[model samples]
Structures are given as structure tokens and as C-alpha cells.
Target: MLGICVCLFAVFTHVLSQEAEEPVFYTCTEGYEYDRVREQCRDIDECALLDDACKGGMQCINHFGGYLCLPKSAVIYISKEGEQVPLPAVPAVPVVPAVPAVPPSQPQVPRSSGNQGVSLSSRTIRCAPGYTADEQNLCRDIDECATGRHTCGPEQTCYNTRGSYTCQCPPGYQKNGDHCVDRDECALTHYCMHRCVNTQGSYYCECNAGHKLASNNHSCVDVNECDVENPCQHHCYNLIGSFLCQCEQGYELAQDTVSCQDIDECSFSSYMCQYQCINSPGSYACECPEGYQLQGNRVCQDINECETGTHNCQDDEMCWNYYGGFRCYPRNPCEAPYAKTSENRCICRSQAECQGLPPSIVYKYMSIQADRTVPADIFQIQATNMYANTHNTFRIKAGNEAGEFFLRRSSNVSAMLVLTKPLSGPREYVIDLEMVTHHLTMNYRSSSLLRLTIIVGPYAF
Candidate 1:
């Protein structure tokens, strides 16, 4: 009886082990369904399958074996009557059927067990808003921008997030409640260096006179007026916002500021030139009369024709230099009773012809400028032949009626002719300077005379 009982326990254990080895079948979760073609479980797009999945202006999002309802608008708006209109409240996360935690590579297969199969059950889960289950049963973001289900207006842009979507105004616009409005950028910031002009959603800059807009469109640069069109006739200077006109050294700026006028420098003073003043376009010139030359800018100096060898004096004649002119005289000037003995001396050949006259005469010529100083010693006379025991006295015998000149004896044989008063000319004078010699020990008396000619010039230099 003990052997039979042990064999019966062994048979029962083998039968139970065979029954436990049979394959078990699995059913997809509430939000998932099995794909007959791919032979795998996939998430059910409940939002696409059910038209009435969401209500009250809510957007429908699909998950694994489930669906969600979310508020269509993310922001609030104002009504036409200025009343605030609130958006719908966000719905709670929808219940999602839990997917089976089966290995994808080795899925549970159904095995025949007397025309029936063992099955595994599934439960439900919940996911956050804006998330949907993919084919792999993983949560992902929905592309609201790509889909027409987004509630963003025409002026707004939509962007998708991991679990939600957002609506915003486009560039150059700002959100005002639920509407988009143009933003005044000019009023918000100092964007322009000069004048600022606001446009639709943007702004531009404008410059004042004599300024130009820079490349940046917001800065102003100075425009050089002189470089474009120079209005000055002579010189142009460009300033910060304007230009200046200037004239040359000898010119003056006209009233129009564009023309340069000549300055009459000669009219300012009569002493501009010693002889004559000539006005030119931009300057003045100093001119001299004939036989004269300009010394400096204003003074006139006489030309020495004799010294410069410009005179036409003959070889037999002597040239006398005067201011602005010259004269020629015979080399021997003595005449009539006076006979030429030397270049400047003459003697009376006949005592009867020289009676009551000096025995000898000497000729001398000299020139001086006009306005000579008074009391000037002009000429010196010395006896050529000397005699012993003789005393001499000198005097201006002729040309002394005007009291212009006097003779003073320095030694026994020499004398000087001095001018006592100033004289001005272009004038000439002839004076007889007589020297009377008396023999101190003998009863003899003699007289000699010097014929001097003085020519005065017209100018000082």
C-alpha cells in the first residue's frame, strides 16, 4: 500500500508540471492595441479615432489607449466691450491604460490548451498634459505648429514644448491681451542720432541740414559743404555745419561772400609812393618819373647817368651829373681874357688884359642833394704855388649878395667855402672865391680867384 501511494504522488507531480509549461497569451493595455500586421502592441490614437474626445473649446491629444482635453487658448483676451474674457481651465491628465511590460524581442504567444488560451490583464495610468504616447509607448510632444488644431491667431506664432504649446506675437509686434499690435520702437529707445521717424513696427532716422545719414542708419555724419560745391571764389573753409569764403592777400571779400574784390591800397595814403601810385587788380605799384627808378616799394631814387655811362657826352666834353639829368661842358671852360693853362685853371696872358682882374683863376664844380643842412663846409681852396713871407686872406667876392656862402681861412694858404643857409633845387649857383696874398716884407700884393659852380639835385636819394 505504501509503494502504490508514492507512485500516485509522482504521477500527479508530472501532470502539474506539464500543465504549468503551457504558453500564456497577453492582451494590450487600455490605451494600447495589438497590431495584426506588425504583430506588436501599439498605442491607440484616441484623439484621431474619436471626434467627440474633447469639448468646451478644448484641444484633444492622444495617448496610449487614452485621450486628453486641454484649453484651446493659452492666454486671455478682452471683449469688444472692454470686458476681460478668461480662457478655459486646463483639464486634468487623462487616464491612460498601462502598457504591458513585455519584452519586445520575445512577446508572449498564445498556446493551444484544449481550444482555449490563458491571458494576462492590464491596468490604466495617467500622463502629464501636452504629452502623448508614441508607438513605442513613450510620451512625446505634439507639434501644434504643424497641425491646424492650434488656436493661435493669424498674427501669432505657435511653438511646441515637451508637454505643451505656446502662442506669441510675431517679430515687430507685441501681444496685447489675445491680439497682436505693432510695437513703437522709436518711442521705446533712443535709436537715432538725429530725428527719429516711426513707421509700422519700425523706425528710421533723418539728418538735419549739412548732415548725412551714416551707414548704420541710426547715426548722422557731417557733410562737407566745401567739397560738394565751393561757393568761395578764392578759398573755401569747411566748418562743422557751414562753409566760409576767404579772399587772397591783396583782395577783399565781397558782400555776396562768393566773389573776391580788389583792394585799392593806393587810395589809403598819399605817401604810398614817392613819385606816383598805380592801382592794380589785387595790389598797388609805385612808379617813378623818367630818368628815375624805384628804390624800394615807395621811394624814388634818381639815376646817375654820368656814373652809369648812359650819357651821350662827347670825349672832348666833361659830363656833370645832376638829379635825373646830366650836362656836357667843354673840357676847358675859361673864355675871352682868361686863357686855359690846365684842365681847371686859367691865367691872364696879357697883364693889360688882366688889369683889375686876378692873375689866375681855378674852376671847380660840385653837386649836392636838395635840402642840405646849413653851415656845411662844401669846398676847400688851397694855393697851388706858395711864396715865402706871404699872408693870405680869403673871401667870397661874388655870389655873396644872397649871403648864402662864406669863406674862412684855416691856414696861411688854405680856405673853406661854407654854406650858411639850407637850399633846395634844381638850381645852380656860381661863386667867386678870392684869395688876396700880401708880401709881409715886400711891397707886393696879388689876387687869385676860384670860380665854383654848385648844382643841386631834385631828391635826397
Candidate 2:
């Protein structure tokens, strides 16, 4: 058996050498060729060889025995050999088998005796259309797509099949008549939540104002302006496609609505504070002037230096309180013809040894705030000695130069002193009030005097 196998190999080698010496014929498919070194059919790379294999910005993808044209942005899968494969949109193509070599039609007969003659049968093999034979005498499928032998147009892709090829549109395109055209995906389907922009052979989503594109690239969501921009000067609130700003207490929004401004509480009204109104950044304060204190939030009250023991009056001086200040006066405000009877009063007892003078002289002291209302009744006087059926009259005997005071009679024996005009001070006034009584039945008259001192303070609290 081994010797017979060696004899058959030598005969095969001899046949191969004879075939080489003659014209050897190799039948290969359109996209394949017989490799002389490997003695087999191999695929052709049309993409590498043809410069215009893929037109219109399409990418050329080489496959087994064929090639594909796809959009530049199309998604593709990779095979184990690191070759690109078409997406599902493109129809799958079957791999074509390798071609085989064809044997010669006639064989040489060996010259030998009848007993040594080997009868060999002659077999003829032929390939069908779109198929070819390789060195192994096997029929292989043709790749007409890779060889540009298909009927597909420039806008279409060619897929190779067993012994055949089919034409189809690439991704992002649809077949229209004899050509492929771009499909308007944005107009056909509502895939974007906000807005859709149609591109060449594709579509994309967009977002409106105050909205942002979601991760899916087809939906929109709120942008949260407060967190992103922080437009408010003090506080900010975000809403749908808008935002709002707010200020803290004692402040208000400015004209721009994004900034905060101080609200001048003092300018609203004059009565906001009794003394003075002070404005701050976020609030206001009420303040009192010298010698006064704030009573409440907006009122000022006098600081009574005498009552509060904050005065510097000496032992011989008496402390007096006025609206917003204090003053010191002599403990005894009496002059000649008057004797001290109390801390604020004096009286004359003997009346100058019974001469032509009033019988008694009294002293009184009082203080008032500056700018006191006019026509104010300040003091009163009455006859100390009155007889039966007596008529009496009162008068400001002195110190009436500015017409600041006048005496009005209330009854037959009593009268009141009135201030006729407003006075501002740090000032002092002295007046002598006198009264005279007449006994109508006896036809005799008696007189007396009352000394009054008025001190006016500096301010009104």
C-alpha cells in the first residue's frame, strides 16, 4: 500500500509539472483570485484598492470577500479579526467559499502491457455563474460586490452572498426609486422631548431656554437657575423657565429685580422717630440727642438730671429739670423785702416798718421748656388780705418789656399770668406780680406783691 501511495504521488507531481508547462487556467470569482504561492483563492480588499469605493462622505468597511459603504457616523460592530461589521440596518452577507483549481480536460495514456495498464476515469468539473474553481478543484462563491461588478448605485451598499450579491441602502438613507436619499427622521418620529433638529441622514435633539438636555440626548429637564447662575443679590428662587429674587428684612428689591437695596425707613415719614431716625443697611435705629434718652423704639424722653442725680449743682444751688437739660438756681431766690419760708418760696413779714409799701412779698420759681406754646398760663396771684365786699385787681407790676406775660382776672380776687409769645432759652425772666384790694364800704385799699422767676431750658425732648 505504501509503495502504491508513493507511485500515485509521483504521478500527481508529474501531472502538475505538465500543467505548469502548458497554459494553466484558473477560474476565480469576481472578488477573488487564485494565489499561486498558496495554491488557493483569496479575497480582494476593494476598499484599499479603489479610491472611490465609498462616496458621499461614507466610510469604506472591508469584510470577508466583499466590502461595505456606510455613513461616517454609523455604529459598527467589530469581528474577532478586528474587522468592522455592518449594523443591523444593513443586511448581513454570507461568506463566500474559496475557489479551487480546475483539472485539464485530457490525460496522457501510459505505454505499458495489458496486465500493467491502469484505467483512470476522466471527470470534468464546471463552476456555476458567480462561482470559480481554486487549486483544490473546489467551487467557491464569487464576490461581485467587492469587485464593483454589482448593479448597486453610488448611494447604495453591496452585500455579497453565496454565488451572488444584493444591493441595499446604507444607514441614515432609504431607497427611493433607483437611488438612496436621506431620511427625515425628525419629521417622521417625535423622539426628542423638547426640540428635534434634522441633519443630513440623521437627527439630533435640542433644549429650550432654562432647560438642559438629559443624559439620553432625546429629553429635556429643568436647569435650576438658582443653583447654576445665582442671579439674586441676597436670595434666589428658581422656577420653570424663570427665577425670582428676594431681600432680607428691612431691605427691598432694586429696579433690576436681581439686586437688593436698603429700604430707608427714615424717609417714609417724619414721625418715625421723635428725635432722630438713623438708617442702617438692613434696619433702622431711633436716636436721642444730648441730655435725652430713647423711651421706646421711636420716642425720646428727657433725662431728668436732678431726679437721676446726674446734675453738678452745688450745695447752695437748687437743681431744676426741664425738657432735655437741667439748671442750677440759688437755693433762696429771694432779694430784699422777702424772707425765705421754704426751698422755693419767700415771704416778707413786716413789710418795711409800715411804710407806703405792699404788706407782703412772696417769691416763686419755675422752669419751662424752650418753644413753649404761646398764651400759656404760667402763674397765678390772689389777695392774701381781703375785707368784706372788697374789689380786687391784678397786674404784672414789672418785667413786661417783651410783652411775654400778662395777667388776666378770673374772679373778684384772683388772676392768672399768661405768656403771650414763644420763647427760646437758656434764658431767664423775672416778673413782679402785684394785687390791690379795696374795701367798698370802708373806702380803703391794701396792696401786696408776688415775685416770679421763670427759667427756660435749651431743648424739647
Per-residue accuracy of model 1 over 1-461 as CA lDDT, tens digit each = 01111011100000011133332223443445444345545665756655555433357755334555555544433242445554334333333323333333344333434323222222111234554546544334567778666888987877554345567676456778888887776776566787888776556789988888888787788888888988789999998777889999889999898799999999898888888899999989999977788987988888889899999999989999877677787898888798998889999989898889898889898887778888899899998879999988988889778898888889999998888888887788989999999998997899999999998876654
lDDT of each: 0.69, 0.71
Candidate 1 local Cα displacement, residue 428, angstroms = 1.5
Which window of ten consecutive residues has the lowest lDDT sum in model 2? 1-10
What are the RMSDs of all candidates, in order?
A: 19.5, 13.5
Clashing pairs in 2: 99-134, 100-133, 100-134, 100-135, 101-134, 101-135
Badly placed stretches (over 4 Å) of model 2 are 1-144, 160-170, 175-181, 349-357, 378-387
Q: Write the per-residue lDDT of candidate 2 for residues 171-214, one digit (tens) a residue.
A: 56777887888877677756688888887777788899988888
